[model samples]
Target: MNTLLLHCRPGFEGEVCAELSELAANLGVAGYAKGKAGGAHAEFVCSETGGAERLMQGARFNQLIFPRQWARGDYLALPETDRISVLLQALADYPQCGSLWLEVFDTNEGKELSNFCKKFEAPLRKALEKAGRLVEDPSKPRLLLTFKSGREVFLGIAETSNSALWPMGIPRLKFPREAPSRSTLKLEEAWHTFIPREQWDTRLSEDMTGVDLGAAPGGWTYQLVRRGMLVTAIDNGPMAQSLMDTGLVTHLMVDGFTWKPKQPVDWMVCDIVEKPARTAAMVEEWISGGHCREAVVNLKLPMKQRYAEVRKLLQRLDEAFKAERLRVSIACKQLYHDREEVTCHLRRL
Candidate 1:
């Protein structure tokens, strides 16, 4: 009854478990995390009564790196004959929810259950309303029912403010047909994830200037151009002629690692395929050395211990900035559009 369920990208379940186990232990909530590799989900079972509450109270969702989303509640194994009754009974003692989201894992089997979830939603809502367990108040918590299979489900709850904006932590972003490459979506997703939408007008204005490293085919550069920023795109390879036609980009054939802007720019972006540590160090230089006021860089991860590598890199950045007495804010996430890498956003405060 004291389990915390976490949803993550498939194949990173071990990393998620490692992260949550460490986090829970650090917060003095004795627990253990369990999940098979590639399960796409994990669970942390607390050792004592109300441990889940304490764990949730101490942990900040945004600070967690491995898990895409999480919820804390009691687990319920439903009867085959009347599954709806089992759900209602399990929720009897819980508070009313402003909304309900029926979720499944991010696996092939989970996708197969999508139709079931959609069909079950209406009846579930009707039952909740009839039983006084559902409300329309945004201030209330949202009920999250995560189904692992037709007969197994985890009944959990999360505050809307503390959870992901969309179900399953997936944002509904579309690829622009005009963009030169599919990689453009990665940068677009990074913006939506890292920068608050309301602050975009001021922080990402068209009047700013930017530098895009490894800008071949002009994927990341296109995003900057679309935002109306003047871009200096550096790469040894060719860029899309259509992007060049915009008259907003200056292409320079040079090494991304060695190339530097003559003066400080508004933003510095890189999507080069290289060791993640190297990319992280480059980003640190750009931010701490005052080359750019802000940056969004991608770190190509190793196959093993990806989360550990990310933590180490972030720690390295923090220590480097602290030693220089620089005021900076940093955030990182494994974006949905990203594979074998994670995106980071750094801004000088």
Candidate 2:
């Protein structure tokens, strides 16, 4: 493989290219990146043969931000009539894939191919299985076919363990009707992306207490209440009566930035609209001050230099944690529900 296909937010193609170029350089792999504005995807082409494979083997997908999913392969143009046969032949040398995900980009044009992809999947799966190019084993690499057009596709390999669980890394979540606001999906998605399902009950146990900064309308606090946790909702605006009626929350009318709990809580969730630097500083202060054991905060990225800004903000937190001698695990992701902000999860170990 000499090219890496990367998926990112629709307008963040430049960020993906910048991230990949930096990552490839660090891995000592010479590669060039390119993508169109608002394409929702990017590609990295290696200057040397095998460099793509080398970079893929060396880079950790979760560590890199911006790109939700990545695959390694060159594009193929197939005749529309016999595309299945063309695909099977292309996989002659590939290892048996554990699974197959026929995907499209997140753009409008990409969505148009969804129906065709759905129709093509069953026959293709049967054909691959019959040919022994696919198996039920989850330990193997996954076969990824991203269709750009009826006659054009990107046939690639996605490492099962190193890749996102969802196709295109977009987790399909049904917005809860009970949620006070649609913004609640950000926290829900963050948990799904950063924490393991099996550990949810333990980490988010019953009776655990949490605080919601800027919690007006109680959208995020609704999440904590539903989980059987007591919450202190901080905001100047009135909260939803449904959440207040739950009897699991304490609504405090105050500025989230200036408030502090009497004692540390189990968790602190923030969604204040502010500059990325300010948001980062808020999260860092809460973490370093032992205000909460864990936190989920949103950083509204600047219009320019977003990736570079994120790196600096994260580094600031890293340095502060080191100076405080705290063992903290921090992870951040741009959730599908998130607009221009990225969610960050911080847990003290």
Candidate 3:
């Protein structure tokens, strides 16, 4: 029970490990992380007893950049015979869970275990109910059973209110055929990830205005138009004719990095392929200078030290905002639709 399991994007295991290890150290929870390069999961094993519990209590899952989902628990070696009894016995020592989610890594082998997990759920839930270890109380903690294989599993627990609403921190979003490009999904996902659904009407209304930098091909701009927003689409390259036909966009041929909106807009979005630092700085300028009340930007990460760079860039934003006495809320995430990049959202509080 001294291990903290984390799920992340495959191939980013090192970044997740580095970030979690640093975070654990900051919280005075000494631990070492272990994971393969493309394992899609990492484990931080605390040397001190109850260190995992301390880390879980000290850190909020939303503040972590790399890990999609996390839990504190120990491994369960499933026996070939009477596996359900073993699972029941292990869970007997833990508190009752409000919900249960059986999961696996994002790898192919993990996917192969899905059917086994699905089949195991019914009997397991029946046994848990019979044993008084499962309940329907939403306020209680959730039992997360992450299976590496049919024979091995990580039985963990996380508070439902603190963990991601989705199983693996992934939102199920559908791509719209009416959109100009597939890139539209990235912005859509960013909004869902950063903004609360209940606030969508007030924050993203049809009467609002927006500016889209590097709006060529009109992926991100399409999202604004879909919201019935009047958008200034800045780019030198040609845009999608279908989007142009909407008559809600004003195309400006200019550099996204250098161009500034003449009037303060409700929203600003940038998806230009540029240095992460530069993008972060520009986003700060937009919010601090009152160019826009809110912004969503993308940062293209480098091949190495991606997590470190993201941390540095975010820290820079924090310093700048603090110095300028700006009250803003910032959130960033590597969305399901994003690749080698992260989406950032900044809103003035």
Candidate 4:
């Protein structure tokens, strides 16, 4: 197969392509990306056979910023009748699969195919098991049957350990009614995406102290407060009375960009509306100056060439850290709750 299927947000299909193009060049995998602007997925068409698989093996999935999921597969068209026989024939030469995933694009059109995928999954699994193509081994490759339409599908394989944990790489999170704004989900998702669940109790414990910049209305502050951490909410605008009543928050009337904590803080978060590069630079000061040991911030992306812009910004920060001789871990993601911005997490070591 020569195509690597990549799932991304509907409006950001170009980013998926752009990100892979740069990444493939670094891995020495020759490929060009092509896809529709509003489509929920894109493909990196490798120039040679097996090159797609080589790219998959060479690039680390977690390091990828745009693609939610990746699978190397071949496009196939199945007959309306006896689909099972045709599918089985296509996979007859393939190795055993650890698990089967029935996926569709993350668009409205794709949601309409959900019932069909649900109905088709059971019989398909039975056929694979009967043919000895399905197994219980965790180390085996995963079978990805991505349905683009009723009879159109991409038959692909992905390494389970290297792929996203959730189907279609979309995590399901229910918004808490208590949060002051929907933006609260962004910070919550950041913690889950950037920090391992096993480390949550200690890293995000009640004993920690947090500061929320541009914390008007207290959306992000609610998350920190719920963790039982005492938070300093810095904003000139009014904050939510409910959060103020909690008594765990100190509402300071100040500018997030210019304000500095009196002493070092355990966690500092910013959801300020500003240029992406400027927000990143501010976070750098917080980390390098020892104002905060950990931070979660959002970078509002530009209208065009966002992938290229973020890469340059991150490269600039990397150079700065190297010069300062500091150890810090930084992760960024376009979260499900985010629109034109990306959430970032930075931790000092």
Candidate 5:
């Protein structure tokens, strides 16, 4: 069994570790060991050959900690250039390797580390270049360099890996590359953790209907329509012409709190830039009254307690639903595109 190291985004080590653990459990990865690197990175070792591939295939695997890896295969003394050359040769033979990155880790305290990094770069770069693939910028290359000590160094290369991440409750979602103008933004759809449409089952209700609070731009409404559901968009602002053209979107120019569907709908989706508590309260009321069968809401967070606030909100939702004698499934995730808030998804039991 090959040793696999999994790395995650900076500052999201804990969440990433949770993600990885979940992956391991679901994928049957064995011999796992996890830790952090000064709070900026999370690292875990697994013994599955396809572990890295599984991690990358999932949408959750955003950036590479070290995309590819090669074992040093030796320990004793050797010249820096010779060591790098030997590692580079192994990298060239590594079937999964693409472009290579260069960095030398100084685990040997007080050693001449910078010198090693500089000397190692030239030959490594040359070796990769001779193989017909040029090394791009060192700062953000597909390859990653890391070391535990003089006795061990890890070299990683970039390649595609597959993991059926969605079956494990991870949403498959991505962000838009360009921001839209105000008028166009209304038509834009923003789903935090949208499962692929094909994955939604009858148990989740395809006949679901939705109410989009602050729907002036109709971005959230589009998400409902795409699911083959009706949406009552509530806001005083103008909705994009495209949404109105869809006919599935209904524009209601009224205050969200004052506006309620004549009958309960399947869901309520909100994107109002308001206090988190207010948003939480609104959701609580709707669920308590049985106004909607499910909901997806956004909570705008303060600069601090961003993570803590979301945690508390979920706890409250659980308690609120319990008091009403209802069972609910809820998920909160900080989307790759989210800045100051998180998206919350809820389904009634």
Candidate 6:
């Protein structure tokens, strides 16, 4: 309980730490360690007895940190042969061979690391087979590349190798504590675990009416129309013909912030380029007025004050809903496709 390992989508390390800091303020963290796993993954360390629970409650946690995942560390400075022996031994000891993820990390100064990896593939694969674990590729084991400056080499391992470790399985929440979706731009087979079709169905309405606030290219709108929902796309730009061809989205050449549905829609989605507060207010208006039962929006954060902006936005949204005597379940996250903003989904509680 003294230490807990946290993981996040790469490039979001600073935001994750900022989020952890806020959560820790309430639950308290003794200290932390941060690093990267190639370009796609990052890790943080905190105490389980410290602010782990609060971190779990943060907007980043639902989207970044997997709650039930366990990570253990093994640091060794052994020779090439010993390193191979140790890893093979660890794999043999592991109850589930498929769950073993052997990543070799060394500092930039370690010129022999690549050669070490080249030399150990045979032994590792043989040991894996002897342990009743199948190595998908005996010759080319996927080794994550990274650089760290320290005496000891640390090999981090995950016990639960579920879809959560897949490239596309991570949920980048739209808003903090709201519904999550895989990146439409980077959409691929790898994302099947990121958001199962079942979860997507729950968030959709078979007969729901809604609007896509920034539906230009129609990524979000495509999802809505496929669910048999009619959408009024409120954008100043042209939408994709395929989206328009769905014959479900009505293109509106009007400002998203100023436009209103003829009547209350069942849902409202926004991916507008606007301030976080402005976007939050729009959502607040729709949710508070019962104009929409559910919403998915993205807030563009300032280069600085990213965490502060996130905190402030959350506070404002909560207060606005409370004032209207309304309850909402919200999720906010830094999506894989997202750069400087977070995606959010708000549903009436």
RMSD of 6: 7.5
What pairs collide in candidate 1? none
lDDT of 1 by residue, 157-260 (tens): 98888877778877788889988899999999889888889999998999999999999899999999999999999999999998899999999999999888
List TM-scores for all candidates, in order. Answer: 0.96, 0.98, 0.96, 0.96, 0.54, 0.69
Best by TM-score: 2
lDDT of 2 by residue, 75-128 (tens): 989895989999988889677899999988889989999999999999999999
lDDT (Cα, tens digit) per residue for candidate 3, span 1-349: 7899999889889988998889888999987999997899999999999998888888888777778888889999998879999999999888899999998998899889989988999999999989999998999999999999888999999999778768877778888898878999999988887888899998899999999998998999999999999999999999988888988999999988899988899999999999999889899989999999999999999999999999899989988998999898888777767888888889988
Residue 308 displacement (Å), model 1? 1.9
Please provide, for model 6 over 138-203, each residue's C-alpha lDDT reduced to its tens digit, 9 standing for 90 to 100.
233222212122234444333232213431233333431211233344222212323456666665
Model 5: per-residue Cα lDDT over 232-276, one tens digit each: 889999987777776778887889976778899977888899999
- Global lDDT of each model? 0.89, 0.89, 0.90, 0.90, 0.56, 0.56
Off by over 4 Å in 3: none
Candidate 4's residue-wise lDDT over 1-349, tens digit each?
Answer: 7899999888899998989888889888887998898788999999987899999899778778888888998889988888899999988866789999999999998999989999999999999999999987789999988999989899988999888777888888888998999889889888888888999999999999999999989999999999999999999999999999999999999788989989899999999999998998999999999999999999899999899988888888778887999988877778777888888888889
What does the lDDT come to for candidate 1?
0.89
* Candidate 1 displacement at residue 242 in angstroms: 1.8
TM-score of 5: 0.54
